[model samples]
Target: MTAHRAKGLQWRLVVVAGVQEGLWPDLRRRGSLLEPDRIGRDGLAEPLTPGAMLAEERRLFYVAATRAADRLVVTAVKTAAEDGDQPSRFLTELGVEPRDVAARPRRPLSVSALVAELRATTVDPAATPALREAAAERLAALAALRDDDGVPLVPAAHPHRWWGLYEPTRGEVPLRDRDRPVALSGSALHQLATTCSLQWFLGREVRAEPPATAAQGFGNVVHVLADEVASGGTPADLSVLLERLDSVWDSLAFDAPWKSRQERENARAALERFLRWHVMERDLGRETAATEHDFDVTLEAGGHRVRVRGSMDRVERGPDGRAYVVDFKTGRNKPTAAEVERHPQLAVYQIAVREGALDGVEGFTGRPEPGGAELVQLRIGAPKREGGDELPAVQRQPALSSYDGDGEWVGELLADAAGRVLDERFTPSPGRHCDTCSFRGACSARPEGRHVVE
Candidate 1:
């Protein structure tokens, strides 16, 4: 019963629970919807003075304590969390030590808790045989107990229902078959070989990819705008392109107004750079064969068949009549010149072209030889030369040739990467990229995450 309802009553024993700060005295000023305090005079109801409110709460507490003729017990809990409970100041004022009381062991509050304790006692090797037998009998009795409606009250106490004794749903099966062909993408080949393999396994194999962020959304819109302009859906006019951007700008979520504005402006700069690059290429007599070209090819790597499927961003027929692969990169960080020279993704695309993946397509009558591939970084500005126009940075990977050593190295890298994927050997390779990895919390490379695997 509430303290207010028990006023002036006497009892042999009384127990006050939840005597924690913010609960007992409850100093919060509760406004009334009826506004009875303002009935006499004034525009709004007046709150009780702090001193008066304290006195009233104290009086109620005193009344509750005095009702117990024999003994009165006040309880509180001190929780471990930062915003957890604390004993009320009233306990100290009543000459009770809050610390000693809070440190005492809590009583079990449920049948399940009692059953768990009894089950533990029954299995304890240190326990006497007689004690273990007594606990087992009690557990059996609890399992047979029923409610007024005949439903078993302690259903979990049944031995057959124990969790630890249950058999696993799938008994000891390997995740992937060793002889099965490993399906891969052009981009996955690059990430697995050049970056961390554990990251590739968790993200691709386990399908634990992180949620898309604002930066990813921004990149997507810019890529779409670039595609539209390239396909002639939207003109090269800045005003027209920006109008289209504004139409879908609200779809992307940004942390703040300033961040949204900044990203929008950055996207504008990217579009301008793309237009500049496109116009420059057109003026140089280059023709775009396809905007988004799809390809699927199978390669024999490490004595295993690896199916590679991916889409190229843009394919252009150079003045020399050789096909050129153009990959648009909207990210700020551009790959180093050395990394670009031996890039796996570009090499895979070149291999696909040589293997007739693009043969009999709209622009190609027969197999078109890959002249070269280049990463067009729209977010990075090219360093201005004395007589050059401002444009996006372009990192080119020279065309692979059978006679040159470049093609042989690419084949070796592909085989090595394919072997790792097939064997499911995803050893964590730490690098600067680990700082942004989503699986860092589960990765064994870090000391804290090591416990997860153990």
Candidate 2:
């Protein structure tokens, strides 16, 4: 009870808890905005001085102390720089010498705490065998006790509640059974097979990928705008594209206003690059067969058939009436020509095309043979001539027909990837991309993630 509420009350023993320096004599100014307490006294002439306020607090403390007729106990913790609980000055003024009191050791009052104590006792090396057995028996009794809802009162005491002690949810079965085909997308082939397989397993297989960033959002907007332009839904004009970009530009989060503006400019440049490329394709007698075309096909790999499925950004028909793949890149870095030759993502699309992925699609005349593939790097500007305007950089990969045995090594990669996935062999392969990988904390190759495997 508060000191004010114990005015005329008497108790056999009274405990004045929290009699600390700052709290017992709270020196902060106290009065409503209307100054009601000062109305009958000084009429708000001036605020009460520190000495006057201290005197008032001392009198209140005296009232609380006098109410205890027989015995009184005042509590205050030892004061230090870290612990600021000092005994109130009133204790010294009233001839009470503060002395340290040894705290009584007691068990915490909670089911979890009790379970922890019992568990510790059962496993204690210093305890006798009989005492440990008694503790185990008590824990079993507690485990048997349940509330009306049927949930155990002490969950930790129950053996069934312990994780990592029982068989896994799927037992010893692989993620994808041996007989079943490992279904993978073009990008998945890159991450799972080419890059880090463990990263792919944790992020894609378990769906533990991190949230998207501002750069990702920017790339998404550019891709959508490029698609709209190709589909004739939006005009291929700079002003119109900027207007469309402004509609959702503020939705993306950036660290600063200048960064946001810079990204906006980059997006504008990407759109401009797309416009130029589109116009050039028309002039070169190349027609867009499809935009964001979905494809799914099965291929023989590593003694097992793997299902490759994904959407192509754009598929074009060349003057020779062969299907060509064009993938727009918003990332600042562009791969070298040699890397593009064996790029897993591009190889997947070409393999799908060879497997009749877009044979019956509209605007695709004759056979859907792989003519060639190119990465239209929108983020990286092309080498500018003295008087020429800025253009997008293009890195081309020749048609599969030009490669030896029609690029059969790509099939070997697919088979290897499929075999690993079927066998659930996801070993961590550390690379330059590790810095941006989301599963670094769970990867065995990383020092920070070593504890997980250990």
Candidate 3:
């Protein structure tokens, strides 16, 4: 059993293997942050000290060994030939009697067969001569150790079969520099000033997030339903909406059965609320003209033209001939009016629609003149009314707004943010969001001339 999962677990015969010098306690490396704790200039607590780390590792191993109901057998390799393979000092510290046991051949402990298997899969059998020689040496050493008392060695194979046998980039495969503007999305650029530019750079260049949770998944399904309904193909009946919602829900692959059921019920309630909202919009002479409209808008930022791109969830035409941009939020965590007033996304979209960003289209002969933006929030829960029956209520809480037509804030904000990015200085601005940041493990808020250097 692995050490992590073996905690508080006991067996009639408990054998703790691989108690070697380089492992077990696995002491901290020489240059590691383990000398004395020091807070870095970034205000992030940078701790140090190998002694404390070793003590903690020892405590865990000690607990694992002591969790024996009947007998405890601690074993290590005593490879006299290999310089580093020595018994763990913890066994000697316990004053346990030394006893040599013969090695037993097992299905999982095949060293020669592993090399053969890898060679068979390789494109060229003779390419991995170094790997084969190393495998041979390990097998010979294990054969010598079989005559002595030590832990039986097992070959922990590499995760990939063709790890060492491959050609580096050749021919037409040319690596490209990441800095060249595959320009960052509008949403990405907007978030840079709010968080740190470093966070955005890390996410764009290094790694991406995994599939979202159930709530997010359900929200995406609702987005698709909204798109379909806005396209004017589907009839706006409750049964029709539910049927489409159920079909979309069924199309999604949910790993958890209970989450699927729960999200479905929640999505149904949200869709019902959305249908009611749609009726009100129609009554107010608002007609959805666009759904999932993609746009690439160029704006003056930092004395140069920078391209910003994103998709609008919905665009509607009012009876007064004014056009509106609408975005849907399935969760109740709607931004306040103050927050929305200065929000980059709304401001940018407002300027884009005003500047004929989505002008030429196949839908109609006319173009949209910016009215403003709205965030439609869908509720799947029913909050109780004061001094009333406990009946459930589904509702759409919308935040509708209109711009005064003074659209210069969009240019100023974008110019400042884009200038900082183009300057190539990425600094971490720590705040409440840092706690939930996925890149928090590697986040260091050190001073200038440190990681902030491009």
Candidate 4:
């Protein structure tokens, strides 16, 4: 619709403006791509002279005019560059007569067109009596916001402010390609933010991580076990499941053997319960979609691109044919539904499903969108050691704590946060979690009021 971009593309009514003298067939007398002296057999496959560039320009305008299927309107204003303008000399060459705008009498202003013009503008110009009235009406409408808040809540800074045209903010940093790529999971983004400076340092400076705790190590083991069993339709009996567990356990890197053993026993009890729950759910009609699904997606935010990866524990296809992403937690202090709604890991899986990343995945023939997600709680079932006999301290159960939300919104939020994490300016935000975080040692080096660790 802009100029001759619609060339060879027909429209019912095509309007061409600046069909005036100096604009179209914008003859740049100086620098054209075609250089005759530089052209030779070895230069390029096909080369043209300066004259040809102008010739092509004429042909483009011709093509622009002929694109009208029904009617063609070629117009030219009375001015160009603040100097008086004239119709193109080519219009006369084409035997088209010109009409003078100054000669025509003014017609009645259109109410509908005036309303349309006002609707399209953020700030209305009082072009005429009608438009002035329209502008007044627009002001009145804006004064009363749709929400209870009188003013619309819009961010003063672009979420991806690093990409703004201007230079960096007074003390802010800009995003740049680093010594290493920015790789983060949705889970990392879901954590509490202490400072912008600290996050930036962790991403760029400290890329490698230390070993996980026994609690974390056990969760990883269970995830691997769940993925393996769910992928295979092997019998969910105690012996087979325990053997698989033993194999998985042997391959793990635990914080301590004693702690690992304690977790392994708890895991074994939970696995049996999960198997029963898994089979029963299937019998009730939920089918497996994908397990241990790995995704690495590149997102473009505020012009910067970053790669995010996450492994989905399970994605189930319901009888309704919609999918649900599930992540397993085997440790204590499992998050609730509200917490899962804020989990970046699930949001990532949701984005992947919708973006065709999981198209060829199991049970997603046409790429069905994820309906929702849940944290598959498989807490440890350890018994209290009291007196001679041991008693179960907690019930053995596996439940789906559903996160009620819109996938697209959560995905967008993560994308913006990823952009910020990748952007320059790693502001440190030290908080209570720093006491246990390995980076707490580094936080102490920061300015006061933001010291991160114990």
Candidate 5:
């Protein structure tokens, strides 16, 4: 039976076992824990300490055991031996005495009964490779450890260490002891908040029925568009798509008409900008001119040779032996030049580009060519006018365009951000923005609410 089906059902006989550490209620990876701002809105204060989590597991066991209608049989294997046995803590708490079930005599079974239990289960061949590889690796690691007095000393396992594999662009160099771990940036956090707020807002209207128009179903439309772009599909028939989307959007009921209109427009504008940016970047990758997108840039930084495989959105060759690597930003909120300067991701990209880690796209080989990088903000919507009768309003100019060419400046920013992430120095910067944040209620910075601890 599926876990969902078991959620609310209580059986006449209930059995709960496996309440060991790292088994029940599973331990979360350090990096998997959300930031205070993200957790705040969810009404969670602080993350659950390991001790609290263990206690919660025990409590869950108690709850499960007490839910039985008549008989309860809780069991646990204390040791891997003929005489080894132990009672679960919850069973002890319930005053149920431990009994040796393994010592019971075995009864002879009929051939049909044995045959019925031996039925074969189908296995997918494609799944074997990964499973075999995982088994081999685990066995090898186990073999490397020495047992102390017959007790296996499993090597210290850091689940979050796998996070490094996800960041291929970071190269193979180990981070220095002084370097901080990376956490979700402000922009990333804001994006999550915005998505949560939009979902909550849309849920209220769409509860009665499905969205009837694309404009009304703005969130769904944007999601579809993002999926299309991520899959490298052409977004050519936007008009037809928008029409269908508007139909879905119009079906939803909203608290305020003007607010709904603004939100719908905003969602549409963001989707359009993202699609355009993705298309432009894809096109650059296929360009034949010196502006080609595919490149391999490599650099030596912090005692590691970092190699980046990607195409720049735009490349402009200058007369002074300088090449400009341009990246497009379709986000609505524009930060000041000073704010841009402090942005870690942009800084890292600039360093990567300058060090030739991204030079392969431009057909360059050997050492990476030193060049500048520009963060260009592409305006997605038209500027507001006092009064205008134009068929389509003129689009507003991009708010800010920032540039950073200094490698040291970029590295410093990354280092600082990385340090904060490692140190777990998360602080909530709440304001009107908190309204959009999913973790707003769980935030420590929220003056009026209790913090959530998970």
Candidate 6:
């Protein structure tokens, strides 16, 4: 069976009846068997290797086991001829215990007993009311169908032709070619499904907003700084920086030049503050704490792990076993605390840390610290006003307060938030905040404005 068949199906107990040497991690399998070759003079004559076939089987087994909702049981029976039979090498590798069931007698099954068992387990408690209603309507429609043999059928079709039956035909074709086959990579199908689901959930078409010219200009400045830092250059010069600010303002395409100037100045100030947090104060720290060789930090709430391969600005470890998650702000203006709280990306990170999903990060410092960490915001901008201190006006502030001391409370909050996520209960809180949201135009709850989409 294909992995797609397992979608949306869950079981409390799963039994993998067979796991043998040639079945589990089929080590004899090679990769070439699955590769498609163009038709040649000899049609359908592509060579297949034993290794490739075995590898494919192994992958199928992996897919099958991952589909188990909770508990998984793998069984392998041994026969007398193979009395000293070693369990599947893959099972040995995975450290699974294989029980010899041949010594026990098999149980018999009756038709009524089997029917009762199916009835007991077929009901789904987790199905939503809407889903139940839709299923009932579908069943009713199916029940209305009559077969040529005068026998009721459940609309069954060959598994290979299922897609064609479900999808609309592009054109009329004879029965022989009715099931026009189309190839789709697993990854491609997954991405397509994800995109379709997102569009359905949003109830509208979705497209990424092109970055503003102003934002792009500032991004160039950041690109230059990043290059210099990579080359071991110190952050002391302001010439390229000033030019960067000027470029950003010039590219604003704003109706009012003064308004652009104000926005550029505000953004520059934020960037400067951010630079201080990274360079001057060195408040951010980076260390590889886990075998994952990524950013993991231990906290009082639990352990927080973050993958910072390309997107990290600066990572700092605090004395109290807290991690200061910092991301650079090149965009104009800063989001408010309420906006941050509503953002799922940040909320998920908080939840991940609280759940101890990051093993290396949890209690790494061997101290109790807040599970809810702080988010530091640094605004980069021009040097402080001439008469005032050189420090930028928009200094760093913790976007999230510490929840380290109250792990239990944080856990409760995360549990509630997780439930909301599972139930898809997100609601947009639009206001002035929409001015900066990339999704503003398409969001249903976005404030009415000239920029809003109908």
Give Cα-based local distance difference scores for all models. 0.82, 0.83, 0.65, 0.59, 0.46, 0.44
Candidate 1: misplaced stretches above 4 Å? 1-28, 32-49, 59-181, 362-365, 386-390, 402-404
lDDT rank order: 2, 1, 3, 4, 5, 6
Candidate whose lDDT is highest: 2
Write down the RMSD of all candidates, one decimal each. 7.7, 7.9, 20.0, 25.8, 23.7, 27.7
The estimated TM-scores of all candidates read 0.68, 0.65, 0.54, 0.49, 0.34, 0.34
TM-score of predicted structure 4 = 0.49
Per-residue lDDT over 356-400 for candidate 1, one digit per residue giving the tens place of the 0 to 100 score: 778876766578888989999888888676113258998899998
Q: Write the per-residue lDDT of candidate 5 for residues 1-454, one digit (tens) a residue.
A: 3223455678798766554434444556344445644356658677678888767766666566666789876666566664554334444666757765656334334432322222111123455666656644554454356666665444322223212225325325433343332333323322222223222222322243243543334544555554444444534455754665576676666668997787676755665555555455445453212432555444433333333345445554434444455555544455555655445444444454555544444444443443545554433443346112211122222211222333454443344334433333434555565664445554555654432221
Q: Candidate 4: where is the Cα deviation over 4 Å?
A: 1-183, 192-205, 248-260, 298-306, 380-412, 430-432, 445-454
- Report the candidate with higher TM-score, 2 versus 6: 2
Candidate 3 per-residue C-alpha lDDT over 245-273 given as tens digits, one digit per residue, 9 for 90 to 100: 77667667777888789777777777776
The residue-by-residue lDDT of candidate 6 on 165-283, one tens digit each, is 25423324321221222222211222222222222223322244454555555555664563354234635345555565565456456557786777666655654554454464343
Q: Over 4 Å off in model 6, which ranges?
A: 1-205, 208-213, 216-236, 240-272, 275-280, 283-312, 319-322, 330-428, 435-454
Clashes of 6: 23
Task: Please report, as a residue range, the 10-residue window in candidate 1 with the lowest summed lDDT.
Answer: 98-107
lDDT of 4 by residue, 1-454 (tens): 6645775478889877777766666666533566565556787445445578668778877888788889877877675455677677656654568776665434334543443344435234536667666665764454343456555422221123212235535434444454444566656655513224464456435663456666676777667667777888556576887886787576666657887787777887777657766776598688887888787776543344556677778888888777777777675654444645555556666666665657777666697766666665666332335211121122211221222233444545554665555554455565544545556545545443232221
Candidate 3 lDDT score at position 173: 31
Model 3 — which ten-residue stretch has the worst lDDT? Answer: 386-395
